[model samples]
Target: MNPPADADSPARQIDARIAALGDWRGETLARMRALVHEAGPEVIETVKWGGVPVWEHAGILCTGETYKAVVKLTFARGAALDDPTGLFNASLEGNTRRAIDIREGETPDADAFKALVRAAAALNASKRKPARR
Candidate 1:
């Protein structure tokens, strides 16, 4: 049988996932949240697909999750990003996804993360162009 979705599902999932990290997970998630908020005021936090914490300004900009040894940052439109920092991880079929896999207890590149957020915001905003009159 399938389970029903709940409002706090995302938060619960986040807590559970972070808890699996044993320690430092809270700090990492906190930093990730700050990064998204600092990116722009329009960035809204929501419980999106797969019960994940999604940051959306124009669309799904990024997701925060804690792994056993790292925190995962997934950008929805990452493939289209310029990503000069080479911070993406190559997934299946040589596909590079715009993401930063920060170590569970390590400090991330704040400047780089901010830059990526700005870039993502720009990209998402541009997609909202008005129709011709």
Candidate 2:
């Protein structure tokens, strides 16, 4: 039987996920999440594909996927956004999505990462259709 949908809100689910991790992966995800929020205060948080943490503004900004050795943050429109800081080290071959894979003991540059988040949000905003006059 299919399990029931998570009753907790997105924020609560994220909090529980981090707490359940109880390790460096959890810490890293939490830090990145905070940076995402700080960079885009209007961004909305949600859970998708069962447990993946998703952040969005006008559209989906990114998804935080945790793995055994790395925490992957995949930006939906990454290929469209400029990566001046070169934070995207994975999924480079993809035509659309780009990802920043943070390994254990490795940390992403906060300022650069935040800048990327803002860029993504801006991209999403740009794509939004204007209201009919």
Models 1 onward score TM values of 0.73, 0.92
lDDT winner: 2
lDDT of 1 by residue, 92-117 (tens): 13354467777755676787788788
Worst 10 residues of 1 by lDDT: 1-10
Model 2 vs. true fold: TM: 0.92
Q: In angstroms, how far off is 20's CA in candidate 1?
A: 9.2
Report the Cα lDDT for residue 74, model 1: 86
For model 1, give the RMSD to the true fold: 6.0
TM-score of model 1 vs. true structure: 0.73
- CA displacement after TM-score superposition, residue 7 of candidate 2 (Å): 6.4
User: Ten consecutive residues with minimal summed lDDT in candidate 2?
Assistant: 1-10
CA lDDT, every prediction?
Answer: 0.71, 0.93
